[model samples]
Target chain A: MRNIWTICRKELGGYFVSPIAYLLLTMFALIFGFFFWNILGYFVNEGMEMIMRGETVPMNLNEQIIRPLLSNVSVIGLFFIPMITMRLFAEEKRSGTIELLATSPIRDIEIILGKWLSAVILYSCLLLLTALNFGFLFLYGKPDWKPLLVGYLGLLLQGGLLLAVGTFISTLTKNQIIAGAATFGICLLLWVIEWVTGYESATWATVLAYFSVITHFDSFARGVIDSKDLVFYLTGIFLGLFATARSMESLRWRS
Target chain B: MRVLTCFLPPSAGTATVAGFDVLEQPREVKRRIGYLPETPPLYPEMATSEYLRFVGKLKGLSGGELEKRVDYVCERCFIADVKQKLLGKLSKGYRQRVGLAQAIIHNPEVLILDEPTAGLDPKQINETRDLIKSLAGDHTIVLSTHILPEVEQICEQVIIINKGKLVATDSVRNLQARTRGVESLQVEVAGRDGSLSYELVQRRLEQVPGVAHVLCRDPHEHRLIFEVQSQKGQLTRGDLARAVVESGWDLNELRAASMSLEEIFLELTGSDAPKETAELTKEMQA
Candidate 1:
């Protein structure tokens, strides 16, 4: 545990020391805030229209605004998660510090956990930035805080799963650009894997749709947390991290 | 060195350091070994002291123990002045020293250095050598370098591997002495008037007792030079000088030529097969 934390701290330091972390944070906030402002504007206008029509059913703020914002944060993460994990192992290999780590007394699992944990933490910080916008909704209106927390939890699980995949890809090469591009490609593919279910109803099609990251995330976005979706995100995270460990082990033997 | 350091696994067989099997117990092996790869493994974004502390933590040092060793190594490696400087901005010499410092920060039993002074200026190389020499009392140091003098200077027990095969393993003095079975003498002589040909001088030296071969070399100013090889355990310096003086030739220079480690390294790791190397090592041991 101590070893993992040390590596995680160093990795977090790596991110914060470079311009990449700040740039990613800023761009993500700018894009997420844009989406939030536009959605909130649309929600308020729709509520006024409902009032004007004498259909006085209270508009659901959670459904109309926060859910789409959380979903957009996941989309924004598709770009930023790749950036967060690109340098994790790639830069270490490029600069030859991987030798230092590889030859150290730490286990491969510890190193992997440390690095992946840091990526998850950085992603959390990005999610925390979106919380400021979420704060606005609470001050002006009453949305169930419980559902908002559940939505953020789902987002965290989904981001953790994808970041694990990115960590695995980062271990495959010494080039950060290749790692980043490959990670983005794989993340996008996983996001869109459910598209196959649209035209086919075969068993394999159902299986493919089941593997889509967005499919499992839909329930949580609806302000509901099912054990099935929780299991899916947890299993996805385990598999991604498992694959990363195997990649790291193979690299030791190959080199 | 990489194999011993647990960086690269061996294709076959295994190795043990400090009674720990590298393949079977890598973490245990790692705990007792300090390795410095050819390039100093450094994070450019980290300051020198911070990097040391980080490496120290990875090596399993905690709190006060880690900080004390960090300070000790920084002072020992002569990087104390640059402790706060970012590693990327530091000079190569300081970077190399920091690499060395990190390796020894944990104070492991075995210190494996791969060409530790490969790319340093003459002064820095000497300083680094002195630091390594000072470290010899506390740790069993394993240093590899293409600079023959470095091995002759710093190392005690030497292992030479050529193309991934063990060429020879012995002490520096033993390798030198083993190659001295057949001794060569550098003899420079000429007539009192500087008229004697090198060929004539070479023939005269060949006639000396115990001389196995004589080769004539170019004249050194007024003196003709001859390299005379004598059989094993022979001392023909006196005979060669007497023969030159008896022939009315002026003996300008006569000195025993010691085989340098560079020459012995080339001879051992050369095209010689493993069979010949094994035989040579066997003969040396005998």
Candidate 2:
């Protein structure tokens, strides 16, 4: 456990010092902020129009505002998570540092979990930076904290899922390009599969959508933290991380 | 970690390091056996001291223990000068020192350093060799290097492995003693019958007691060539010389053939003479 924390500290410290982390953070802020502004603007305009007709707004302002912002944050995470994760194992192997790491007493599971946790924390921090969006919504209207907390929970869940997938992808190759591309490809597939299955009426499609990380994220974005949705995201997180640990273990003996 | 006596199999029979079974207890075995591969894997972004501290921590050293070990290894490997420098900026020599320091960080019972002096200049190589020698009393170091002098100067026991097989394992003096007879012994004889004389010499030499077998020599018009191997504890050079004198042959050339570690290494590793062998011989004499 100490070994895991040591690895985590160094890996997280590395992200802090390197330009890659800052670059990804900037990209995450810009893309997420842009999507949040556009989505909130459209939703607010529609809500104001509805109010002008003398009918209660369809959704409360908090739901109208924070939901779109946090949901879009999850979407933006699909891109930035891989940027930080692609270097975890891939760059270590490429630069010959993997040998040093593998020969140490640290377990494979610890190493994978350490790097995964670092990515998750960095991704969460990026998400936290956009918290001012919720503060803005709270200032002008009555805001319910439940959905806001649910929305943040959903964002963390989605980030965890993406982090696991990205870490597993990073283990597949020493080339960062391949790691990045493979991570993006897997997350993009999960995203598209959820949308496609939603269109079809197949009962299995609903099950697939239920399992889709993006779909499970919707429950959280809507401000309701369902146990089943939480379970689905947790399953994704565990499966991805488990596979990464296995990959590292196999590699240690293979060569 | 205590090292038990064992052998590295397939290469030979059984092997153990610090009482741990390399095959059965690889983890425990690894704890005692500090291995530095041909290329030491280093995180270039890390400072030498930071990397060593991390390795020490992973090896389960306490904070204070880690600091002491790190400093000891650094000073022993002569890497203290660049402990604060990032690994990326270190020279090939310093990098090798860093490799050695990391390998010895835990003060393992045995050290296995493969080609430890590979890329270092003469000064660095001497410093490394001196360090390895200094550590001999307390640490059992298995230094694998193509440099024969490294073995001669540092290793008390030399195990020569060729083609994944143990060709010889003995003290340096004993191996040199065993191979020295065959390697030396200049036969001085003038022959007129040419091929017939060579065969006669071979047959006659084999007939001598304490003489193993005589290797046929290259055809020199006036001189016949043959290599003589003696039985254990018996040298027949005197008898052979007397035979040549009695046979009425003019003894033209006779010299004892002594081989250096470099020559022995090349011969054992299945390679011809290294280009630098000549310079090494000159250096050894100087």
Candidate 3:
């Protein structure tokens, strides 16, 4: 565990010192801000129309604004998660520091976990940026915080799942751009897997839909914490990290 | 080297480092060994001290012990002056020093350095070699390089590998002695006549006892250089000198020629015939 934390701290320190951290933070916040403004604008316009008709329409801020915003955050994460995870191993390999990590007295699993945890932490910080906008919503509107918390949890799980995959892809190449592109390609495939459900309702389609990240995230976005969804994300994280450890093992042998 | 360091497993053979089987007790082997690959593994963005501290932690050092070890290595490698500078900003020599510092940060019992002096100025190369020599007894260093002078200057035992095969493993002096069987003699003779013919000198030297072969290397009018090869284990320098003088030639110089490490390396690894001969000789001696 100490070894893992040491690696994690080094990785986190690496991200903070590089310009990628600042760039990702700024890009995420700006995109989330746009989503917040558009969502809130639609909600306000609907509320005003209801008031002009003198009808008392229930405006649940959590359902109307928070859920959609959190869902949008998950989509935005598809782009930024790749950026954060691309350098985990690829940059190390490119700079020849992978030799140091490989020959170190730490287990392969620890290195993978350390790098994955750093990416998760960075993604969490990006999610935290949107909380400033949420804080504004809470100040003026009567929004239930529990559902918002669940929504944020969903975003984290979703982002972590992609980050884990990205971490695996990073180990495949020394080129960061290639790693990032491969990660985005895999994430896009996972995202669009649910489209098979739209075309058919067969067993194959149902399985494909179940495999889609968006399917598991739907319950969390709607504030329903299903055990199955948690299991899915956990399984994906475990499988991704397991594959990464395997790749790292092969790399050790080849080196 | 990677297998000995437990970074890579051997395909067919076993390796042990610091009394730990690399295949079975990799963690123990890793704990006892520090490896520096051909290129230094470094994070350019990190300061010299910070990178060393990070590597120290990876090698399982922490707290005051880590600090003390880091300080010791920083001073040992003479990089304390630039410890605060980012590694990328540092000069190549300093970067190599930092690489060396990380390898010894844990004070591992074995140091496997691949080409430690490669790609350095003459002064830095000498300094690095001196630093390596200074750490000789405390650490069992496995220094790998194609530089023969480095082996002569630093290594006590040499292992020559070619085409991924171990060609020979022995002390440097032992290898040099093994290749010294075909003794050579450098004879510079001044003839009575201004001109010296190669045919006359070659025929005369070949008739000398213990002389196996003779070649007129340089045939000048007043001076001639003859390279005389003696039969295995034969002392021919004295016999050749006497033969030249008896032949009415002024013997200016006659000395036993020695083979250098480079020549021995070429003899062992340069061709298939000599390699087979060396292996046959090894078997015969065994």
Q: Is candidate 1 or candidate 2 better by DockQ?
A: 1
| TM-score for each predicted model, relative to the true structure | 0.92, 0.79, 0.89
Candidate 3 ranges beyond 4 A from true positions: B185-214, B218-256, B270-286
Q: Compute the lDDT of residue A210 as modeled in candidate 1.
A: 90
Give the top-scoring candidate (TM-score).
Answer: 1
Question: TM-score for chain A of every candidate model?
Answer: 0.97, 0.91, 0.98
Global CA lDDT computed for model 1: 0.86
* lDDT by residue for model 3 (A167-231), tens: 99999999999999999998888888999888799998998889889889989999999999999
lDDT of 1 by residue, A225-253 (tens): 99999998899889989998999889878
TM-score of chain B of 2: 0.64
lDDT of 2 by residue, B1-286 (tens): 1112112222335555567655566567656656566677777778999989887877778778899999999888889999999988998888887888888899877777667788889998888778767767666776666667677776777777664456677777776776665544556567544434777667776776677667766755546766666655566567777777666665666676566776666665557534332121101110
RMSD in Å for all candidates: 3.5, 7.1, 4.2
Per-model DockQ: 0.82, 0.28, 0.69
Candidate 2 vs 3: which has more lDDT: 3
